[model samples]
Target: MKKLTTLFLGTLLFMNNLFAQDQGKRFYKLPIYGKYFETSQQFHRVDTLKYNTMPASVKKLYTNSAGLFVTFKSNSSELYAKWCVTDKKVGLNLTAIANKGLDVYIKNRAGRWQYAGSKGTVKTCEDGLILEHLDSTEKEFLVYLPLYDETTSLEIGVEEGASFVELPNPFKRNIVVYGSSIVHGASASRPGMAYPALLSRRTGFNFLNFGVSGNARMEKEVVHMLGDINPDVFILDCVPNSSPEQVSERTVYLVSYLREKHPNTPIIMIPSVIRELSYFHQNWNNRNHLQNANWKTEYNKLIAKGGKALYYLDTSSLLGEDHEATTDGTHPSDLGFMRMVEQIEPFVLDVMKKHNIH
Candidate 1:
């Protein structure tokens, strides 16, 4: 009787395990290779030749592609993703899916970027997480990767037998943005939510995000490297990192160096976005005014010389006067980032149209 009881228990355990495996068999998954698809990642993990040449400071900053994206086409009705992020802590105020997370945007028949679904970061020790499925008929899709986290590996899966094609990296001559933490996607809800990323999704132009956190001071080395990539437009949004003296001293050289290299390409100079701290702190307010004053002085000098390629954006109203745009006194919240996008959208569109890049 004891032997019979043991045999019955073993049989029940086997049946339960078998049932679980059978249930998992319903979804067919295939790995999407990084080599086949186009990625906005400027540096590959394994590409040491380029990595070795960089200054240690640059290598650390350039390794993260905050606003980069992937473009692909497939006949599969279902789209899925499995990604591994190196960071254990995925997000802060933004959810995991928006920070170290990835999201999907589809170009509708109307040619507008519309939200699909996202794969939120997983807490398990496993290297991968199965993402939410995007239900659709045959369509092309854009996958926006993480903003703040380092991606170790990523693969997109689809229906077992549908056709798949890798779209070319849309940017030949990219709109290269060099700036402060905002360009690095600091506190953005997701990678795609960054202003440069938004411009890409909305306008169908390719952008290379060169945001380097607080280190985006007018480093000449940074400008020299930026000159190598032929840019249709150069967005210099680095004012937050500079003081009025620094802006006054370095702004001309930085603009002139790029202007000389890419004479035809448009360059947009943005004064610092209004910091929330300025409202309460007199020192901060005075600094903001000084920087803008220095910037406007520079702009007027260029305009006097008929410098049509150079442009200026007065960012005093970026988040609007409601005074509810930031998470910290300096860094913008997701809402703040979105509002920033709203103001720049038309300006960029008009610039591209004028240059025939659109």
Candidate 2:
């Protein structure tokens, strides 16, 4: 009877330990969407207001035969992903979908390439698609895949199309970035290779990208959404979306609103990258300059108002003196993106140190 009691006690303790371990494990349902496609009305529509202003290159890129790619980052040695894709009437098949894989390049660490062990074409199942990683760990990893066909919608998650398993919460000291098309990653060559993605990789932090192409006007709705997320740092990089007056008006209000809920949260304001020419040809050169000035004014105001947590990062020096970092005088090329990362690293590190989040 004594031996049986001892055995039962040992088993109970082991089960309790298992439950604790599982609870400490974290999972993230990262999102990946399919390529963009336009309907007939969108393709052939002629608007008198914007006629002849559209770039030929932009039109070409949006036409048939183009696709959008998505990337995922993970640290789990064993990974399982489930995704749901919508087949929007267009009858083309997915060309090929596989992990873009990762080149484990690290600072002061030897680089190695890790490939997805699974092979063959993956089809969207009724319950969604699943991909598994052979090994799981605490180190960071990147997953890249291309989306083809007329698919317009996709939902990705872990086992239940929602379960990510046994990984650290990189967002413990969250960094939320808000901006325009550049921040949304217009043309970064690969999905996960964008600057924000790279920054997440370097700093090992969770990133929430609130970049909407040509849509970041410091709108009230956007500010409200930003306030929903509790981030340690909030980065505003929306100079490309507003005129000087609009920027000034919204900056003060947005900052004030955020301060109301998160009195101690640090906010970082960034100006536009030095790029010539404009998408709308609306005198952006002067607008960008004034936006910077207004941002400084608001930043100083926050400082004076006993908000010592406010910070400003001048990104002017990021792309070099000649603005060589941009691809088409607007968006960043691969090289330009890397340089941007280099500039932001110091500021990020400072924030990390203050918060003691590695």
Candidate 3:
């Protein structure tokens, strides 16, 4: 009787294995977008060789793949993702999906990018279904990486014999945004919810994110690196991470260095978004007022000194009046990020037009 039972269990296990193997899929590497250096294959925003020179905090956050995505065209009836993330931890205020997950977007027939599906298990590596049971029509797909984790490896899986093609970047030029944690995609539910990513989809521009969390203080080394990129447009939103004194001292130097690098590029400065927690905390309130004031003073000085092609972004309505836009009163929730893109997109488009940034 025992031998009969063991033989029956063995046969069942073998059948299950055969069934899983029959569902095998083929994977293809997708081209990454939004990385600062094209030569980097590690999904890092900046060149890894220079990591030792950057601030320790920046060195860590630059690998988070905050604004990176992969694009491809496929006609498979179903889709899956095989990915490995550097971290498998989630923050108290951040979603596990946002930390180490995948979000997929598909371009509809009307030429609009829409969310399709997402997968998040907070594992070091995972192979899971993203979407299935489609009509097998060829379409462009965009998959956003984790918002707060480093993507060491990523590949899209499709049924065997399905047509798949990696797509090239479709944007015109790079619009580099340098800022703090808000730019680093903190508290966003997914990677694509970051304001820079939102701005990219809305305006059809390649907005590269250089959001160095806790280290966008405009230090000499960091500013030098920014100057080296010489993007078509530069947006500085680092006031939230810098003290009033630092702003007063660093603003001029940072802008001046970049101006000297790319004399014709448009340089815009934005003050920090209003933190809702500041309403009741006197210290927080005072800090906001001072930093913004210092920023305005620096902008005036730059303009007075014949800083042409310089612009200022009005951030009064960046978070709206409801005071419910933030997850922790510091970083924006997805709602807040959407509100910011709505306000910022038009102003940025107008600025680019004036500067002939096509």
Candidate 4:
């Protein structure tokens, strides 16, 4: 019976592929969104030309299209994507779909974005249907690129005669978020479910992700590049990647440098969420405790020195008391990401509102 089931599934997929090819579709280049600088490449977060001295670790991760996406409008019965990623990397803690897959969201008539479809690529490049049997009405789409892999090329496919147009980025103001693997989207079920991505969808604002996996250690060159963006709000969530000593030594410099560059921009600092393993591991628990203390101490010192628009975001309640929010006791799973968004959305919205960022 298992052999028969496998055969049936394989046949179905083959037919689907054949059908997609038989339809004779037209492909158009998908324009990327969430690009902060004009690098030599399209999906890069930084222009390596100017900041040639950035650390090698940061230079490598900056090319991953974590927060990037593409938008378009189509009036077709189906949608397809043909794309390729640079490295096609895989993560032990993260799903391949979230790391190097495509997530599609369509805007309803009410102006709310809804998850419509998703597809994970199996090779360096694959052409497959993302969604079929649509209502054939004109509507907007937002397709989030890979969160951990760099998208080297992408094209959206629609019916040969159908109208398809790439839309301009809807979100105007940028809220830059710089952090560790959590911010880079470690264990999200899909790319769009990451906390910063969720925040962007919920608020209809551009929450640019600068998540660098294990590399967000508050380095001087990284902080300087962040200062160059000069966003409306700056969110620092790098505590997880930095050791307690690193946090103590770098927090002041990180905050002070940004303050010196953009004094009035709201600099929101987020300490690491409680790791479930820390509840049982004394060293991990102690390390996290010390890191939070140091982060808050630096914030207080900056405030004492009249640092304006600096706020410490308390995320102790992020994962809830159940402690089932992580995939590896470190990175948040989809449920954990949802909880994070729910807890974080209100505070973030309030801060942006007060500052009249809308």
Candidate 5:
């Protein structure tokens, strides 16, 4: 009994020491994304919201740190981040699922992006955070920003005596995507697992995710702002937010606006993913079909109008007929997200190949 008690005390002390070490070590930190963070960090967002004298509405949307990446080379064995989110309350996804989370990816010697580790906070990043700890060898790393939540403050921290420098943007062309909540990362397990994030990784290309939850209606304000982008391919996946009437009304204008602005840029249109409610409820089927029909009509019209760089993707098989791809019947689960990438990446790569944007 005495020996056991001693051993217990020793184990407890060791555990405490580990926590103390984690708490005591200070990190050499860097902020590497966002417009507000540009002078201090490498900024990735230049959407419609960045212009001078921009409207208050646009400012509210562009303020978040979504779709930003922190590129760096570090030799630290420990990785940490200090972040405070604007929204701490958990929504459809859990707090850890949506808000206080960080994912770290490292490039292997074979030039493949591999998942190194992930961190979750029960509290908020206002209290700071400690993410993955790696070997003390120098390596290239990219940290993806949170998808659903807005960040107020962010800093990447590494161990002392580690060599660190900002990584230059590697790709020449941008993978521009626009859509609704799913594009904004509804139920993704982490910020890094969002469909756009996955697509960027698989292709090793740059991307800008313009998915705003419930607000990506085919508004002229949004589309007109989008016209300024000169992307390799502009992906449209916002039909789920629009009604059939809106689809018929706005689809032509949206395509024409983009085509007028980027005459040679390939535009890819993605209709709504298959909904589980359609298989169970007739109303859902009718509503979804109507919207798709309207969108199809507009796409065909654009083709007839001599859309030289247009590409329309029929996503009927995106989530598959089995209908097990979503967290609810609406948003996709991680499994569904993987399935989505597998299907979508091939088509995107094909478009990229055709345009020589690879």
Candidate 6:
């Protein structure tokens, strides 16, 4: 009788612990939609509701109550979806849409966001796909389309009919990057190939890419946006377009503004990658040297002012010791991007580790 009672108690305890673990895990439940883009105009059409546009490989389609309208083409093999939510309360939604159905993946701050819970299948309703989470602890979310060969078009949105109860965001470290075209990922083969994408994969944290194609000046408005994000690390790599004086002046104010909100977050200043400048014919050497000098001067000043975590990365040795990894003359090729990743990886890892991200 005593032995039986002890066995029963052990079983009950095990069941109780299992239930507790289940309750602790986060669950996402939301509906999602997919669309295609045929032209720049069509792509802009989906920009309504502050939605961000996907790459051009997908066809053009939009939604307006009646449901989503998608066009089918024989040669098409890509699909994209766009949506925006200023409300940080709700987590991301992942979904799929198609008669033939396609295989896909979703990754979040944990890295490599891939679809969960279901496989490719025809949908009976317009918004038949769903993915959702309420936890704000997650920094970044990603949806990967793995069925790139035969599959096209995917629907992604926050899970529908799910309640969102605000919880504390557990992520402590944030990364903010300021740069020009390459940082914005102008012409990578795919979205995942972008350097930000690569770095996000390795570090598993949230990052804000303030990269503007041909427009990342030391502008006050841009700095305001960066300040709003309130990152843990600020990286300025805008040497592709600014003069040395502009870099020094604008960066000083930007760093100061960020320091107001997050006094401890590190600022990582980078110089331009090595490239040929047919316009100047001096190559990227002169511009790089001048920018480095300016950055060092400002960095030292900030340090002298008792800045605790100001940091710098010498990108001259990043792509290669002799400058061998560019595509056109200014932008990074795939190989160049990989090399850039190698250079910044150490700095990022150290910062994240200090904050206990991994």
Candidates in order, TM-scores: namely 0.80, 0.59, 0.92, 0.92, 0.84, 0.55
Q: Where in model 3 is the C-alpha error above 4 Å?
A: 1-22, 39-41
Q: In model 4, what are the clashing residue pairs, if there are any?
A: none
Candidate 2 clashing pairs, residues 3+ apart or interchain: 76-136, 76-137, 77-135, 77-136, 77-137, 78-135, 78-136, 158-163
Predicted candidate 5 versus true structure: per-residue lDDT over 303-358, tens digit per residue = 89788888888767677767888887878877777888898889888988998886
Query: What's the lDDT for all of these models?
Result: 0.69, 0.52, 0.86, 0.87, 0.72, 0.49
Give lDDT tens digits, candidate 2, residues 216-301. Answer: 67777557656766777888888776777888788877888887878888788877775655434567766667777888887888
Cα RMSD, model 5: 7.6
- Highest TM-score model number: 3
lDDT (C-alpha) at residue 30 in model 2: 39
RMSD versus native structure for model 2: 15.3
For residues 54-89, what per-residue lDDT tens digits would candidate 3 score against the true structure?
777787788888889999999998999888987546
Model 6, span 1-358: residue lDDT tens: 9999999999999999856533423333222222222223321213323333322221111121101112111111222233221111210111122112222333344444433322333332222332333343322233322111122233443322322332222223456667776665533333344566567556655444445555566666556545655555788777667777787887778778878867777777777765544335665567766766787788788888887667777555556654556656566666777888888878777765676655
In lDDT terms, how accurate is model 2?
Answer: 0.52
Score residue 325 of candidate 4 by CA lDDT.
Answer: 91
Error of 5 at 10 (Å): 34
Local lDDT at 23 for model 3: 70
Give the winner by lDDT: 4
- lDDT, candidate 1, 315-335, per-residue tens: 667887888988777778778
* Ordered list by TM-score, greatest first: 3, 4, 5, 1, 2, 6
**Model 4 segments more than 4 A misplaced:** 1-23
